[model samples]
Target chain A: MTELEIIRLYRSGQQEKAFNLIVENYSERLYWHVRRFVCSHEDTDDLLQEIFVKVWKHLPSFRGDSRLYTWLYRIATNETLNFLHKEKIRASLKFERLSVEMEEKIDDDPYFNGDELQKELLKAIQRLPEKQRIVFTMRYFEDLSYEDLSEILDTSVGALKASYHFAAKKIRTELKKSSIQL
Target chain B: MGKDILDDLKRNPYSVPDGYFDRLKGRLNEIAVSSVDTVPRSLWQRIRPYAALAACFAASFLIGNAILRKTAPGASSSDQFYKELMYSDLIPVTQPYAIFEMEDEEEMETSDEDIINFLIETGVSVELIAYVELLED
Candidate 1:
């Protein structure tokens, strides 16, 4: 269904149809986006569900100001930032808290095969500043245009291009150092 | 120069764990059922600001009415004064006898020409004329 139809269904209280449309339209795309930011499958799973829940709650406020995908990406970006911020705060309060959760989630995640190269790439991504990482993931992995990235990140096209460039450079260097191809 | 890196990143699409979306759909359904009570929580959220605004408007109306009621009597009296001034020309001389008596005495004492000449020669102010009339009364 078109975004308008989906919105109409949602506003008409047919939330099931609306959510089904969301799943059909964006599940895989959003999964990849979430996966890029988070390391393990369990974390991505948790974050993905939370992102959709947030989307469901806030969809009424969307107002069609931007494209549906851009709006969704903006939500994803915010959730990821919040997740990172909370993790940082928790770590500061007790350093072991983040590590323990990370270890448990990583160990328990069935989808995580823990390939050395993927691990290295994730570690490199974790080191990036949030904006660069988001830009890079959107541009490289999600294949979003500069315009869409700008809307999602609320950054200028030039700045987003620069961020992506720097992110790629960092990732390439990290991959090389770890002797991981591509 | 670094197009190759970007290309590689693009080519190697990230794989999600199998059945992630299906599981997510189930989890969402679970949340939806469990969150029926939480749904009303948002109803309160939506109503909160409007309720506050309604209270403010009601308070303002009451305060305005109170202030108006407090000052209404004074305002009405001032309005009466202005109304009297507007219709002053229509005010009837209630005691015509007194006015006729005053006019006759003044006419006997002085001719109109004498009064005019006195006014011209002395350059008597209107206030003096009013005072003389008052003294005669």
Candidate 2:
């Protein structure tokens, strides 16, 4: 279904139908986007449900100023970041490092089916600061352009470029420290 | 650079359980329909946690003051008592009010009320909040 049709259905008060269509179209993509941030399928699943609930509740106020998927990305990014932030606090309360815990989660993640190098890459990526890690995942895994990232992150394109560069360099440094070849 | 193995490991290494998306729509719809008529929380509801914390602090401080008045040997004047309390070994310098300083990097934009509301809304138990408060004490 086209974006216009969805918006029209929403406006016409056929919101549930429009929303189901949206869930069908965007749930998997959004799932992948969120899963890359969280690195746990269970967390991703719970967070995805919350994200879609937010989207449903707030859909009435959506003014169509941006493309629907960009708006959806924006919501997904914010919710995932918020979840991570809370997770960080929870970890701190237990005197645990959030990055270490997340890397451990990646290591034990049953859904993860990568080779040794890919697993190490994910661990290195998890060690990055939150925003930089999200930027790296969205750029490298999801293949989103800087413009899309800028819109979703509400960051300047220049800043996003610099963040991605520093993130890549940091990941390489971490990989080298682990003696992972090239 | 050995052709940058980062570029070589390009395929996404994640998978979901079978038919996860197939069930997601129905699950979300159930939540949405049930929650559609739920009113937004009032401001008072949002700030109740912080207000409770403040009330607890005030009550505890007053009780401590009263106990000090009855028990301290030479804490005659309220001013003198406060002066000693400020300088006394009773309250450690490191632990005082530091837990309340929760303005971390991620929470700079969030208001205190919002944080309290978020904690409560996320099912942080009253005992945990009190435990955090006890940590503050």
Candidate 3:
């Protein structure tokens, strides 16, 4: 179903049908977007489901002010930021707990393949400030226009361009230092 | 610099490992079955500001009512008026008191009794009081 029809179905209380339609429509696209930011398949799985849950809850308030995809993108961006922030706070609050969680993931997480280069790239992305990472991911991976990034980030187009430039430069340098070719 | 970097990054494609989407879909279906009724945090965030604003308005109205009871005219004006009335009789006499001819004895007697009681309570003697009793013709 088209996004508009799915939205209509959801509003009319056909939640299951609407949800299935949304999954069929955007699951691949959202997975790739989320996977770019969080390399671990386990983390991306959690984030992807969380993103859809967010979309379902917020669909009623969608005024069609922007395209449906833009709205979804905005939610995905915010959820990723919040996830990172919470992870950072958790790490600060209890370093041991953070390490334990990492160890548990490393030991038993079925979704994590432990690809060295992809893991390094994600670690470098995480090292970036939130705005730079967002700009970088949206620009490089999602191939979003600067205008769309500006709308999603609530930043001026010029600033987003600058942020993306700096992020790319940093990522390239980091990759070179690690002796990994892009 | 921005254009150059953007173009280069565009040339580099970031790919998810195989089956990521399928796994994500499976996870979503699991969540839907497990907790189908729960709303997301982002939706609640959008409405939170309005809830806060309503709470502020309710608090302001209650506080205004409390202030009104303490300072509005009905609460303080009557007490102020009674105090002013009590002090009005203390003003000094500057001129001769106005007198009119009396016409009845019974009313005069009541008035005289009232004056005697006033004097006894206030420590004024009958000699210090001025009498204006009406004589019956």
Worst 10 residues of 2 chain A by lDDT: A173-182
How close is every model to the real structure, measured as TM-score? 0.58, 0.68, 0.54
lDDT of 2 by residue, A1-182 (tens): 89889989889988878888888889889999999888899999899989998898799889998889899999999999999999999999999999999989998999888888788889888888877998899999999999999989999999999999999998777767665453
Highest TM-score model number = 2
Pick the DockQ winner.
2
Interface RMSD of 2: 1.7
Comparing candidate 1 with candidate 3, which one achieves the higher lDDT? 1
Clashes of each: 0, 0, 0
What fnat does each of the candidate structures reach?
0.20, 0.64, 0.16
- Between candidates 2 and 3, the one scoring higher on TM-score is 2
For model 3 chain B, the run of ten residues with the poorest summed lDDT: B95-104
DockQ scores for all predicted structures = 0.12, 0.37, 0.09
Q: Which stretches of candidate 2 lie over 4 Å from their true place?
A: A176-182, B36-137
lDDT of 1 by residue, A54-113 (tens): 887787687887888788888987897788779868777875555445445444555655
